[model samples]
Target: MTVNSISFPHPVLGNGDDISDGSISPEISFQISDESIRVDVTSLQTGHPDFDRMIEAGEAVWHLRVQCPRTYMREDFFESGSNKTFHLEGVDFEGLVTIEVSLVTTTTLATYRPQGLHEDYGEEKFRLGRGEVVGIGPRYQFLIDKIYDPLKAPVSSIIRIEEGEDSEGPFTVALDTDLIMIHLSKSDYKEYAGITDRVPTVIHSALVLPVLADAIRQIEDYAESTLWAARLKYLLDIRDIDTEKPLQAAQEILFSPIARTFREVNMRLDKGDD
Candidate 1:
């Protein structure tokens, strides 16, 4: 999420307050190259005397969090200075990466009041619990470029789900030059693809899993040359899935949907949802 989306409990430095006004000034910069992302915090100054006092007393500390949700990667750094690098050797970061800096309370603070606590807050002091953010910097974003356009990539991309004719079977596979199309019978498509679109796992478990499993088996023989298979193989190779075991690889890549189904059901049951 962006910096503006975050709701801070109190006035934080660097939002709009100037450095000369005794606010925080974190001079942060970053670079990405050759399978590594480096972030530098050249200067971290808590200009306000109250914030400075907390830092000196070890009640607060700096936290730098980096996230690459596309690659399922998140790392947190507690260093108060420069030179932080995150290695991304085997991770495939196909989209956005974000970095956030926050000053968090290390210990619970009673009746804490910063130097310039605004009267508009309706209180001069606040009881801040441990781990609460005392100050926050801008949330930075960087886009990672991809060789293939995401909208045309296979499976959910070029290989897509379609509604089949009334006379067609419940699930049908059509392998084309640029697509691996899975057609669900008209009624089933309406139910799963249309009405239940928000929860895609239902469709993936029932339809995509079998189709992907079959595609994996045919990769070396019938489907290898197809664009769908090429993309599928790339996905498996990047995640280090063993294609020799087709069913296992498909399940692994799809995040073991059968198990996920049971877990979801149990969660709903626990919540007493109908």
Candidate 2:
């Protein structure tokens, strides 16, 4: 079977408000209400453990941002408010088609709002608060650029796939589950790809493979533990597979190490580390 669309399911970053991901909610757009642009999210009480606890606390702040395809950051913070509606009218939303979501903790919410301050975040001299950006799913160079450690985090910067459809919900990895490589059939690919018009043969081209492979290699170069080295090897093997099943193979390779680290390293969940 031919590979179609690809998805990057973001791993949960934190225990509470420190996590924010695009898969929680679909692409939310601004509704023109009189002189204001009204942004609304429909996904509620998703039962995702990471977000559910924070939503229960009533101290979480949601941030919305959109970026252009060509330019990594051709968008800005439009508005911010409670977990519901965001109103803004300053920047142009024309080229900024990709929407990203950030769920900041109570500590971050009180310190900084996501609007007007978008520019400040870029050049802020002092340190800023911590949180997670579940916004925008993973894209090319995503793992190479950064691989999140569920252990430590002040904030998370997620990937937005340019090739995937905005309506195709974010790839979800269960809090209790670890990403594993599955020899996906066309049916599985369809499930991941969702309903898209174009059939992409491969997500990681020849040029992209080496870069990703190199990144995974670097992780092993410095990994002190034998288990870590073995885990990293799985990742490297997946990268070189060069089959139509790149996404599936990579996820398993990516997730196996995570499962090992979390299960073996520490009782993060039991101790409430987020």
In terms of lDDT, the best-performing candidate is 1
User: Tens-digit lDDT track for model 2 on 52-124?
Assistant: 4555664444555544332344434422333455554423332123345555444433333222222323533
lDDT of each: 0.65, 0.35
Clashes of each: 0, 7
Model 1 worst lDDT window (10 residues): 145-154
Distance from true location, Cα of 72 in model 2, Å: 9.9
Error of 1 at 229 (Å): 26
Q: Highest TM-score among the candidates is held by which one? A: 1
Residue-level lDDT tens digits of model 1 in 151-208: 3433475357777887445677876545678777877777765545545566667777
Error of 1 at 87 (Å): 4.6
RMSD list, candidates in order = 17.9, 21.8
